[model samples]
Target: MNQIDFITEIQKHEPKMFGLAISILKNRDLAKDGLQESAIKLWNQRDYFQKVKNKQAYCMQIIKNWCYDELKRKVNNHLRLQDDEEVEEGIGNEKDHVNDTYRRIKSLIEKLPSKQRLIIQLKDFEGLDFEEISNALKMEQGSVRVNLSRARKRLKEMYLEQENKIKMIQNEE
Candidate 1:
């Protein structure tokens, strides 16, 4: 891609990178820093983009790596701030259900092994095909699909269990 194409690519994916970062880091400021670093890294390797079969996926992989690094750094540094916060307070009541679901999903995602979580996020949330995810992850296609499927199944079970517990609690109430 050329100069204009590169700018457009950045514009298209900037939000996704930021969102993914925030999902993993749970801090807006830290997410922004990770996005900035990813953008800089992409810029430095602009020429290498031509060789990539899927640039967006490649950039997303970069962002994913940065997020994992940030997560490790924060935990290793022993930060006391709770990872969960009430950031959805401004979304209004109408979106509360969806936001709650997302928060629950994020919590589930957090519990996943990093490899499984990465596969699920790339395949499910990001809407990438197996081949694309495999290429981005540098893994075989079958491995990517297996990981994604397992992650989704586990998350589904977890959500169902949580739902049942909530229902039981409500009945008790």
Candidate 2:
């Protein structure tokens, strides 16, 4: 494919790519950087493109790897981003408050095991169909469904449990 075609192909998948990146990175700025990096990597490896049978899959693989590396780097550096912390702390009283349901959802999502979190984010928030989610995560469609269900179930349980605990405290007071 020529440069224009290559650009077009990547652009076609841009929305999905951005969603995947944000889900993985959990930071808009970082996700944008990761997406840019993915495109740059694809461009650099363009000569080998023909060797890969599925360009979309190949680009996804690249993004996944880059996200992993970026996450690793963040962990190693012990980056404590204030925004995520605020969300986690339920401090939505400010102008940036995302609302109770979404806040609870985000809280539960953040508490999920890494794999489950990613699955839920892709399926619930990004609106990737089962097949697309499976393809992106390299899990089977059934597995994706099961994982997503479990994630939602767990979130529901946690929310109810936490709500009860708060009620108990309030009653005691």
Candidate 3:
């Protein structure tokens, strides 16, 4: 791809890629840095872009790989820390139930196994089809679908269990 086309393509998936980075890194600043790094890497490999079938999947895979590498480096350096405040901004002093629900679901997702969590994020958040997810995750399409199904089922079960616990607490109160 040419310069303009390559840039346009990257911009098209920028938001989803950023979201993936943030989800993995859990910090806005680091996510931004990851995106910049991924962009530079993509630019360097632009010549080979012509051979890529699903550029979106390829972009996501790159971001995922880079984020994992960053996480490993941080772990090795003993610098792994939570960026709770920067994770999801504007949650302070708000009476928004939707935001609460979002947080709860996000936490539930975080509790999922690595493959299922990644598949759920890729399919639901990034809006990638099974084939794209399979390509990005390097899994079979059937495996991707099965993992997504299991993830959704597990999330629903967890949500219901939480609700039940809330109800029990209310009853005790």
Maximum-lDDT candidate: 3
Query: lDDT per residue, candidate 2, 1-173, as tens digits?
Result: 68998899899777777878877877777778888999998888888874777677677778888888988887899975333444445465773455666776787788998788998888778777887787778888999888999999998899899999989999999
lDDT-based ranking, best first? 3, 2, 1
Model 1 misplaced regions, further than 4 Å? 1-3, 19-26, 68-84
**Clash count list over all predictions:** 0, 0, 0
Candidate with more favorable, higher lDDT: 2 or 3: 3
> C-alpha displacement of 135 in model 2, angstroms?
1.9
| Candidate 3, superposed: residue stretches over 4 Å from native | 81-83, 86-95
* Local lDDT at 90 for model 1: 65
Q: Give candidate 2's TM-score.
A: 0.76
| Local distance difference test, each candidate | 0.77, 0.80, 0.84
lDDT of 3 by residue, 84-144 (tens): 5522547666656767777788888888997788888877976778876787668899999
| Cα RMSD of predicted structure 2 | 4.1
